[model samples]
Target: MPKIPECDRCRFYCGSHYLVCAVLPSGPDGKECHHFAPEPNAEPQELWEPQGARYIDDELVIERVTYNGEEIIQPPQRWSREKKLWLLDNHPMFTGLCPSCGAEFERDFTARVHWDCPECGWKDDSV
Candidate 1:
C-alpha cells in the first residue's frame, strides 16, 4: 500500500507499518482523498497576500481604503523625483522669496499660509 502526501498530516493516519489510515486501510484511489482529515494540532499556514503586495521585516506593507464596508487596495501616491526637486527650486514657500520682485519673506514664512508680497503687491491666490 502506497501512502499519499496528505496521509502524514491526516488525523486518521494509522501510523503503523501494516495499516495506512482507518478511513481507507488500503490507501486512497487518487491524489484527491475526500476522506482526508486535518490534524487538530497542525501548524498554522502562511498568510495569503494579494498580487503586487509583499511583506517587509515580518510586517505587511500595503495601502488600503475602506468604502461602503468594503476594503479596496490601491497603490500609495508619491510625487515624481524631478517634480519634487522642481518644487524645492521654484516654489516660493520653499524659496522664501517672491517670484516677481525677488523680495525675501520672513524667516517664519512656512507658518504663514499666504505668500502675498508687500513690495510688488503680488497677491497669492494659488490656494
Candidate 2:
C-alpha cells in the first residue's frame, strides 16, 4: 500500500488540498514525512462551560440557586485579583490576625470576605 500519512496536521500543509502536502506535492517519501510539523492554525477545539461558571485555581465554579423547587443558576460574583491575593495572605484562617489591626480573631463562616476588626475598628477594604 502507498504510504500517505495524514497531511492535514503538517505545518507545511497548503490547506487547499486534502492529500497535497507542501513538503512533497505527491506525498511523503515513505509511511510519513521525516520533518512533518504540526499546523499552527489547525481546527480549533471548542470549549463549553455552563452559564455563570468560571475557573478559579484551575477549578470551575458554578452557582446554582433554587427557589420554589425551581433551579436557578447564577454566576458567582467576580472578585478582583488583588482581593483574592489579600485573602490568601491576611485572612484570619491563614494568618490568624486582622491584616490592619493585627488582632487575632476567628473568621465568620458565612462572611469569609472583608472583615471588621473588633479591637481597632479597622475595616478590611481589600475584599
TM-score of each: 0.32, 0.31
Top lDDT: which candidate number?
1
Q: What lDDT tens digits, residue by residue, belong to model 2 across residues 7-103?
A: 6666776544344556676667677677677777786322356567754433566867888999987756567679888788877657878777689
Please write out the lDDT profile of model 1 over residues 59-111, one tens digit for every residue.
56685778899999867546567977876886678887877889988878646
Best of the candidates, TM-score: 1
Q: Ten residues in a row with the worst lDDT in model 1?
A: 43-52
Residue 50 shift from truth in candidate 1, angstroms? 21
The TM-score, computed over Cα atoms with residue i paired to residue i, of candidate 1 is 0.32
Off by over 4 Å in 2: 1-77, 107-114, 124-127
Compared with the true structure, the alpha-carbon lDDT of candidate 1 equals 0.74
